[model samples]
Target: MGEKGECSGVKPSDDEIWAKLVPSDSRYSDVEIRSDEKVICSEISAAFGDKHSWCKIIRNSDLCSATVENKSPNTILVDGTEVHNENTVVIKDGSEIIPGPDKGGFVSYRFDILSSPETSQRQLQICVDVENAKCSICLNIWHDVVTVAPCLHNFCNGCFSEWLRRSQEKRSSVLCPQCRGVVQFVGKNHFLRTIAEDMLKADSSLRRSDEEVALLDTYSSVRSNLVIGSGKKNCRKRAHTPVDDQSDGTYLQCPQCVHEVGGFHCNNNTVHLQCQACGGMMPSRLGFNIPQYCSGCDRSFCGAYWHALGVTGSGPYPICSQDTLKPISEHSISRIPLLAHENNVHEQNITDSCIRQMGKTLQDVVSEWIVKLNNKEIDVTRLALNHVETINARTSVCCDCYQKLVSFLLYWFRISIPKYRLPPEASAREDCWYGYACRTQHHSEEHARKRNHVCRPTRGSNM
Candidate 1:
């Protein structure tokens, strides 16, 4: 939070300071951090452009607090404590930080954690729509989802493969079952296959028997992407052209496949990631510094594409902002997101009160635990999150990922403290049966606040 602990930088704007600070909130657990920001300072100053005198927010990582760094030799009071030059006082939520001796300068701002509206609304479980998943040929749920290009029709892999084989025997061009466009390309849609499996699980009646599945698997031919029969035996063989030439092939191709863009051309084997934000296509760069995929939603984005291409969003073709994607370590946040602690706003409130009573702020508490986490002083076995094994302070994660990490670490901090040391309200609470998995934690804020979710099962409690 400091130049390894010094404080001598220009004061920043409120928005700028908020961007660097990361207060804990559970909602950010699944959301991306604001991508458009660029600044990464850890402190805030009350007096900007002042050479001789001012107040500053000092990040004391060793002490686990954001201290008020009094640069002015005069007496500076932080929450009524007289602070001298270069010395610091711990900052708390709503603690008044006054610059100049005895508040004479009139520069004052209160340290506070900003909270956002809760986002726990989820759709109720409902019946699966098997009809949408059914293939036109088989009239059953798709065995393996395959999307045909040009017409963009989707069908079972087995159904398409069989139709393809029959069409080839007659030397006739293949046609889309639904749109009748000459099929120019086809690919196994992995994302859709996952959705199809979920549908079968939701309604077992939609599932085909194992024997049927095995037969379908044998007949399926679509692997990654297949360039289907070109021109028309479906319509006359045209002149030889690049795969992207619509005149050479009846079906259309993705934007990247058809033209030279950013000094690159897509050949037969280029794996592509379609941007979820702008359906543009960019070659997938696995293990590359260019961030093509968002760590939060596991979706591809084109922000890095524009950046790498040395182009702007104002380019003729659609170009996403570079802020859309970046390494997680590159993001600098200063406030705890409001949705931390599994969206249980109440638990965060209790933890905030407990920290204040102990003469510390939320930032101070999180800093202490983060140091423990980095030193391997805390156990990570029971952390509730995906990819738990790979999570660490140094891991590059989206904003949501960072919040989830903070929430998990905070849980450990609360539980590790002795019962007597906990705030009076939290000290007397009983642990819930569901722990972090309780459904009520999502819907009822009161219930989540009343019950302690950090405790282990008692000898006679419900399992």
Candidate 2:
């Protein structure tokens, strides 16, 4: 008997006796095991045929643990293992117990420790690599991590928002700064933001200067998930025709002036949405299933709606081509996008050289990867695009987004190459310490040529 219990030599404090047995059979009540005495399996003896002592629970030195000795003449089982008569087995919280050998007619009970031990109050430790918490764009701990769809890459909210603004201004489509995937959606990731914040709190040195943070905050416009638009321009050539007299010089002629389209005719009373692609106007029909607005960006485009109505570009009415906004499957890529590999020209040249060495065109490699992407063979965890799971060959995307997708696929193409398969000169080079995030590759031609940038960063900082 324990010091506190008559059955064991070890003794637990008065308050430490919290172990008990919870019977599986509702007819039997719970059996409390005290440190001062051992618990005999008498409460559930009716199910076991007799009230004979089948088992005895003796308290151990640890308040949360106890030892169960089989007292029944027949064998019993504790947590699936056989415990013969006189054999004692250690029991902890949630340990299952059954009497009379295999579970045929005997009721089972769970040994539960009602109170947690003092050691359980200690703080927990978790391992998280700081490198993963840094933003690829700013090369620092994320200020407010934002995750982009399709690619699902993370970045600082201010950094990505600024990138989004610049990409939108420079082109109709917004490309991810990290993977160059056309960003269909972007929003602040509360989970990653917490991790980033925790990392910064752990190491203050990773934090950016107050001034830099303030500036970045000012540039952040993304408060929630934003759907980006492909800035497709209307490229259809207008035919020579007379302008409508009712049309003020400010508005282009509506298609309804010629004839009814899709069983609906436009009138002066009908509200109209101006086309962002071409300077044209189309009647806004909210009830119609026809898509007058680009899904990528909520902006209105007369191309799909007009095309659905069998209307073509004329002198009086300007309609965009179907190519302006279509499904991602219809989009094609011929050349390498300049935005590939974080816009590193050296890496781009190396990739181009490698492609030529393999006797493959950029288009061939892109098409092959697209097949892999559609087959779900590729891991898109690192790809920085919105609605990544929804992206496939048939997914609707703008021409710019398609280019961005091609660029992202090309990256996987370059990185997946075996060293021996690379050009001899390229194969001889080693990987940069900072990998794709290497800043030196942008400025130092010798360094860029000597080291590869397609790999992940070995160190969190250039230092």
Candidate 3:
């Protein structure tokens, strides 16, 4: 009665009455109708729409994980950012498939998102959304969602364009849709423009866009001109300082915001350094920088110091909370790591457990470099500086090749250096190796240049 997938919202005794048929004109470009009798679709939306329709009519085809593209250039872009690249694939959903934008974006790994390998949580997709660089706005939420840019704010497309066109007639510029910064440019990364055009063409179901993004560059410059005569206001409310606050004399913070407070004003880096006036430390790390602009006042806060926002411990500062609240950042982000030194070595690269695999299949990574050095194909200086990484891994040397390698190491020592620096009263192989001095001496740059440290098997580690 109500097109193919439904029977007039009445109880259909058999699924044949309804359920098996899909309407010809679908609203979403992201979906496909594989069957004429019934659209292959997810049961969730289908049942919710037609309550009386029998549940059995919902098609139960397991969409195979396959990559698809436009048969010709007839390939319409479904969603600009969704399947943005030529390599993007559509995981089949029963007979229904996400329709177009059948091209764009490269893929790192094939994941069974809908029903296959559930290795990743469903939330992982949102992480991909945040990282999309094409759109510069902050809240890039699409499907009637928007990202705010220039002002770097997001508003619905309709909301933004209406706001922009109307606001242009009267004032120098309007405040941002979200932040209220005097607006300037939305730049080229206009996501709403893309979304509106694609949705209209595709006959989509996503809601309407609201507003455009803009930034006020001139305000800061004019304020810079006015800084000499501007009056300052002071609020007497004192923020609660924890008993366990660090002894660094940082007591001043924003009572309202709790970020760092500085000389009669607030600064962004107050997270790292204590406020000169109020002694409050602000937030610095955690993927966020300074917050000089306050949402309360259109003007930036100039203070004795900045506001403090973080909870502190005697050891390391507490993990910042701003990112923890977001669904995507919490689950998808990797922690900031320490600065890796040039000589830093990981334990996984070595260890007999890795080297002695089920049968120790030959891997020539380490051996190839050693052979190159022995042949003098490259410079010795680079070889010495780089050898640390290659040394730990097991060589691909066969028994015969291993013997030749051992001979080469010995031959290298004999030819390159005048002597192996044996003890005053001991042999090069005995006293030098047993001494603690050998470990220190051989590992140094100068010693490495004189003798190559090639991996040489000695009858299966008997040495």
Residue-by-residue lDDT tens digits, candidate 2, 1-463: 0001112323444654356665555345455554645646343433443345677886666555778889878788999999998998998777888877888777677776644334243324456788877789888888878898779999888888778756755675677888887666676787887677777787888888999999988877555445453444323356535344232232344777456777887543333566767766776665577666444444566777788778889646778877776776667666678889878777788789888888888878887898899999888876666567768876655566677788788889988888888878778876765688765456545456667888887743322
Question: What are the per-residue Cα lDDT tens digits for candidate 1 across 194-264?
Answer: 77887887789778889998898788755445555343322236653433334453333444555676667
TM-score of each: 0.43, 0.44, 0.20
List CA RMSD, all candidates: 19.9, 25.7, 25.5
Instruction: For candidate 1, give the lDDT.
Output: 0.58
Q: Report the error of model 3 at residue 441, Å.
A: 52
Q: Candidate 3: which stretches are off by over 4 Å?
A: 1-175, 178-234, 237-265, 268-312, 315-463
lDDT of 3 by residue, 1-463 (tens): 2222222322334311111222223321122222212212222243355332221113233333333332222232322334332333443322232223332221111111122122123323222233232223233333233343345665444455456545545444455666776543332234454644554445433333333223321111111001110011323357644333322222233332333324223332222322222233332222334432222111222231122333332323222223211111012211111211111122112211222432342233224435555456533322222122332213221222233333333223323323333322212221211121122223333322222222222211113
What Cα-based lDDT does every candidate model obtain? 0.58, 0.68, 0.29
Question: Candidate 1 regions off by >4 Å?
Answer: 1-263, 267-271, 278-280, 295-297, 354-386, 441-445, 456-463
Best by lDDT: 2
